[model samples]
Target: MKDNAPVFDALDLDRHAFFFDFDGTLAEFTDDPADVALDARLGLDLMRLLRRTGGAVAILTGRHRAEILSHIDPAIPVAGLHGAEFPGEVLAHDPARRAQFSPLLPGLSALVAAFPGTLLEEKDAGFALHWRRAPQHEQAMIAAAERALTELGPDWVIQHGKFVAELRQSGGDKGSALRRFMAEPPFAGRLPVAFGDDLNDMPMLAAARELGGLAVAMGERDLPADHRLSGPRALAEWLERGLA
Candidate 1:
């Protein structure tokens, strides 16, 4: 672990831009993604954080726009689908790309059928096979992803998370999301502070630290984050202490 500082103190040094990952960061992960909900205390803490940052907060998640908004309910801009700039829909560039990826879902779904506890999830620009409930089948799940990618073409890439392997469309990531946000009003000229708990989040974390702000790892992971917190509860408590 590197030398970490109080987040509030870091924000106090200059104008700060806040970016957060949804699952495993703001909220705990659930077997069923639909079962996940934003904690009320998080809402309150976010409300306070927003007031302090002057509305420079955003959610950078792998979820779709509707799914993320329905939970967090923050009026602030969100970059979902790994920074797809979901306005009206999650896809920012081409609508047909989603359709292109849709046909591949059934194949991926079938690939996970042999594993009883695995799940096949389709996202706006991609799909995933989660094996959190079936840890023993991880290698098989990964093999399935590799086989799917061989047929899916080079337009997609495989990413890993806690017991989950995913395939998201090319061209965008959380780092690009943060960069785009940094170029906009309220966020421009401000230092960025990012938080996340997965490997895919590394780009955004590096982006934040590179921009001279801060990156925080929400859970235990070997990553570069100026600060670290045990979990969402610890994060909330830290925010409260800052406000106090």
Candidate 2:
């Protein structure tokens, strides 16, 4: 990572498409994922950037599109479930594949029940074991997710974040999602600038840089990026500067 990065500005916005990760990037982490709220000021700035960029802004997140929509303008495009889902994209998995998760749930549920403060987040495409409030159970959570993946077979994979581990289908990832978005209207032909804060965000960050654009890492996690921001509050302030 470079110590000095160019100051973000409207000029950069004019030719670059903006991509952001939600938790820990746009909003701070909360013990309850459901309680993490987007800052109103940050939302407004994002909307303004979207408009200024001629609809070139999109959020690529591990969250479901609807969940992100609840916090921001529904008009802005969101690629959710770590790129497993997109606007107007229909996903149909084989019955056998769908049934695979069924076997994992009961065990995962039992584990969560056994550990106080740990959470199990069920998404449309996958599920995650979060130990944000129960740090001592982190290894247990990861082990459970790994076991779930093993049972699910080669079709499934694991995604690790700060205090969570997810087991989902193997095909889609943040980098692939970023490339897909950049191939479409209002996004194609524009530079890509991605902002993220966790391991899940790594692929998206690398994709942006590989595309001859910029990657802004949020907080510290040894992520490679063109620049870095302290955290979500600093990111919000950085966006404010671009608006000026």
> TM-score for all predictions?
0.91, 0.94
Error of 1 at 225 (Å): 1.4
Per-residue lDDT of model 2, residues 2-103, tens digit only: 333347753466678989999999999999999999999999999998898999989999988888999999878999989988878765555676577876
lDDT of 1 by residue, 1-244 (tens): 3324454764662488889998988888887777888788887778777777788888898887678888765576778778875444435555687776677777677777878888999875678889887899999999888877777789888988888888876788999889888988778999898998899899999999889888998887877887888777777777777877
**lDDT of the structure predicted as candidate 1:** 0.81
Whole-model lDDT values for every prediction: 0.81, 0.87
Model 1: ten consecutive residues of lowest lDDT:
1-10
Candidate whose lDDT is highest: 2
Task: Report the number of backbone clashes for model 2.
Answer: 0
Residue pair clashes in candidate 2:
none
lDDT, model 2, position 236:
84
Report the Cα RMSD per candidate.
2.4, 1.9
Question: Which ranges of candidate 2 are over 4 A from the true structure?
Answer: 1-5
